[model samples]
Target chain A: MNIHEYQAKALFEKFGIAVPKGAAAKFPEEFDTALSQLPEGTTVVKSQIHAGGRGKGTFKSGFKGGVKLCKSKAEAKEVAGKMLGETLVTVQTGPAGRKVQTVYFTTASSIKKEYYLAILLDRATSRPVIVASTEGGVEIEKVAHETPEKIFKVFIDPAYGLADYQVRELVFKLGLNAAEQKAASKLIRGLYTLFWETDASMVEINPLITTTTDGVEALDAKVSFDDNSLYRHPEIVALRDLNEEDPKEVEASKHALSYIALDGNIACLVNGAGLAMSTMDIIKHFGGNPANFLDVGGGASREQVVAAFKIILTDPKVKGILVNIFGGIMDCNIIANGIVDAVKEVGLKLPLVVRLEGNNVVAGKETLAKSGLTITSGDSMADAAQKIVKLVA
Target chain B: MAIFVHEKTKILVQGITGSFGARHAQLSLDYGTLVVAGVTPGKGGQFFEHNGHKVPIFNSVADAAVATGATVSAIFVPPPFAADAILECSDAGLDLAVAITEGIPIRDMVRVKRAMQGKKTRLVGPNCPGLVTPGTGPKSSGGCRIGISPGYIHQKGHVGVVSRSGTLTYEAVWQLTSKGIGQSTCVGIGGDPVNGTSHLDVIKAFNDDPDTHGIIMIGEIGGTAEVEAAKWIKANVKKPVAGFIAGATAPAGRRMGHAGAIVGGTEDTAAAKIAAFKAAGIEVAVTPSDMADALIRAAKAQNVKLS
Candidate 1:
């Protein structure tokens, strides 16, 4: 689960991280009022979206007509109206621009220090890593490529909490003064507290900047929580914006299944977590776009398979579904019944490609073939992948 | 006979009265595994029946292990109490412990890992489906997941398979069984970073077993455990081996289910491990169906036959 930038900042501000005050507006008219609310100076206007690459689209296109110095309120309103609802090209959307639903306007601050900060899962260590960098305002990935030494990654001890000594050292490495150092420590500590309390998988603040002797504030924030841990956190659940997510993904999560909506036409559902991923990859390799990754786990029953098919059919973009089951302990016949039941109940009409292996594979193929649902069975994975790819193509 | 667990390994359930715990414990005891004791703090003195015998209940791991001489512990505590339960089990000097609970804090596992080190104790999972010594011990907890796969899928043979994926292990065992291969033992090492032992740990035990012959390895994309084991297999293990990896192209951006099952982690993606295995001249299966053929080919290629 991921939260928007403003929501994360609100949490940080509540924890006493001094952040610049700003208002979120959806239109250029709201933008003008938002700018007027800030101190009469060069104000920074940022696009608010769940994904990155706002500047590459709307902000540059909408806000760039002319710099109208508004000493009065009237000038701001007219300028705001033009920018409202206007689509602009962002790096995210390519030449096609993403719609700007909201614009954040705030008084720009003097940055004496800039650093990168994020809490991400380090899979090798299976630990949450607190990565801080002296170089701020730029994407940390670039720093990783150009100057890897600048990034200092500290693996947080989830049991003991973030070590205070490590906090002090991180502050020192960032080259902060006494006052900034204290504030940074408080921010990092508070961030950790928020991370734990909310069960966040990641909390990122790019360009956590220190103003000239004033205080440190988060320039941008991104928070991601463990979906499995969401049951323990009601507050995080209330903050979830259904509008910011893929509708198919939202529906899939309800079934306790992991679904990543892709730009593919093949709706692939496979049993076993590992096999599901490979199924998707094979679909892609066979010149078909995979619409999702659905894992029915190892012991997927007829019911689970039905639910998986329903989830895939929900996506209109799906051209067909490829059902790949490598029969382990999970009976392939049970899974075939699920596929038959789901198709039967939902009146599903998409082409189905199935490649089954192991126990009762023959019986499973026979069951599906007799189900009378445009079913295609392959003796091998390559054959299955090729059939689906051709069907969609 | 499987190492670490067999018919004689006395078992104890840490949360015997819980729903999933008691139910699975019943299933396990029925399967012929000797379950001597159960432990649930404050619920001590209560007893449960397994394998036609009434087992004594205790309040702590030490009490259970000591009183019953239990060597293996199965923990069904919820996430919040998981670390403490494992620690207590470790302190009891048990030889092996399985923590079937999920969402354990990394710090807790680290401490548990450190404390269990140099001792006779080994921990299986902080968040996983509990281990099963099939046909030897009772499948203890309802959630500990015995026979989540079909019981008949295993042929009861000489191949010892170790994997980080719990379900995949069931899948591999099923595949091996269909090909007329019975497993000496199947181990899910758990995908948690702080969880006990590695692929190498189980492989070492399998290598020492005279009954165990060829091995089949199934790994997901994440961590270096599989890669590291491939290297070890290349150097040591006098057995024919073949491998398969799931999530071959798990989008570079998207992650797998377990926080630990990511294939795209530091120097160990599924591609990387497969590369290492192929470089070591190991036959890698392209799909689950191919696993049987690959393992068969590896055996023939090595001119090795299981007795």
Candidate 2:
């Protein structure tokens, strides 16, 4: 649901938010053409991947990790060719890392002022709030921590839309005078339009910077759309960066793991994510390691359940598999049946511990009671995690 | 009779005739949720019966609302049609829309939310365990055996139970019923971050009811919703509110099953909510059984003697 900086900036530009003039180059040969297309002199070649921490930590000082600043077309092409099809492992890419497929060629903007602007759903207020800070570029969370009041927020009513009045308020608050207000208004409006059209959960223009020319531009753009809302926007679907994602996550999507990879080795597969995290924590509480975090969600099918089982088992280091299903909407008997089928088909040699609750627990227990699949059924989430740790240890 | 829906609150199933739709329709009718119409977009003018109440399945919520005066909708469509289904109900002006579909994208919810702006229609959740009013009767119109427990578990008195965890609510209800601590209403608002009615929204409704004397709140880790509700409980709740936060198994640094249940830091932990509620002078339960025990104790402290 996250679009690349180039695509986000392009959308920003369409709405009159000035972005560094750039084009995404898919092929190494396309780099020259793409660079020539942009106003040439000094350009920033940004590595296009889903993760962050890219420019400095990931790539070597200037010419490593596919992201390099070059003055000549030949240098840009050389860097692009080296980075193309190469898997770049950056901090943002996570421990497993993702393959670099595309790179963005952008004309570096000369900045006089750097400010941060982002809009997110504030759960406390139950409304979309626009967060703006005079200080940009660095982590906004840190800035909020150091100087909380500098980050002014304006709660937006979905009914009225983001008004020009709010933008004017922000423009003045950010210390921009008359000339800057006109351009800043355009950027805010463009972001709002893109936010609506893309069904984005977040649209952040970090470094809503001012150029030496006294004009405003969005130096970097980050837009995260709601995955559930992807059905309405097909155009955004094509920009998915699948290569730079977790293998288990990719497998989980089709197999439906509701899986979010985390640091652990116990491989907790619970019926709900809330319950799953607790299960993983309890494993650690009892001196155990969780291999990954997976949620089957409510009312999962036998196939989906089996698929989740397969995904967990795929991790070779997974010493134990914890299946904790509260069985709220889903029946415990159905879950038991799925677990039985999964053990038979997938061959569960790993130690298995389960805590199934809810409707038909008796039947579910009866089904699992007879299954001699090296499984132990606990009475509670804590008890189950404790048992899984005992078995694994 | 239930306040919003009863045996006669003309109902419409947005994906009527679909497998889940048909199954829940049969159950809902049995539980006293009067389902009057079914909509399948292309498969209108079809006839389906649940508990001998001929539910005329229409093509859309608008059409069904018009044809049968259906004022409520229970959506059982696939996750993909969730937004459209809710919007259809809101546009048709259903008093309340309960979305039973799980895995609805957050983006779709924002749009659906935008669509419901300024409207009277209130949505439950795109991924929730449908509403339950216990006994007089229930939304069993969908026949989801999950929500329909042994009617004996609830005593139909004055306890309002609200939870983010779906099945946990049923466990509490079942235990309360066995103890003869029946409820006025028990709502299982699903764990998704952008669900329609929040814990506070449901609690306010419970507060207005004269029949309700005490409240039991169940929350998991993740999101500030529970914390926000705790603040509300401290400020406005007149009745004794007993609480339990599940996800004791949730580790310190990961998102649990509910998108909102992830522990961001020590402050956002389940322990944090329990402490806040305790500081606010609300009774706290450590486990499901403890939750039942706490509610019983809370009820007794308020001196509401049950037969």
Indicate which candidate wins on DockQ.
1
How accurate locally is residue A248 in candidate 2, as Cα lDDT from 0 to 100? 85
lDDT of 1 by residue, B52-128 (tens): 66988998888887798988888888877888898887788888888877667654565566566677788776655
lDDT of 2 by residue, B1-307 (tens): 3334433456677777888778767766665555677888887887887556887877778888888888878888888777888888888888988887877876567657876878999888756666666553332222222222333234555677888776567666766765667677777787777778888888888878776777888888767677778888889987888887876655554445565665655567777887888876688875555667787787678776532
Model 2 chain B weakest 10-residue run by lDDT = B139-148
Give every prediction's interface RMSD.
3.8, 3.8
lDDT of 1 by residue, A153-237 (tens): 8886555668989899899888888998998999998887777667677788887999987588888788887765676678878
Share of real interface contacts recovered by each model? Answer: 0.36, 0.37
Query: TM-score for each prediction?
Result: 0.84, 0.85
DockQ, per model, reads 0.37, 0.34
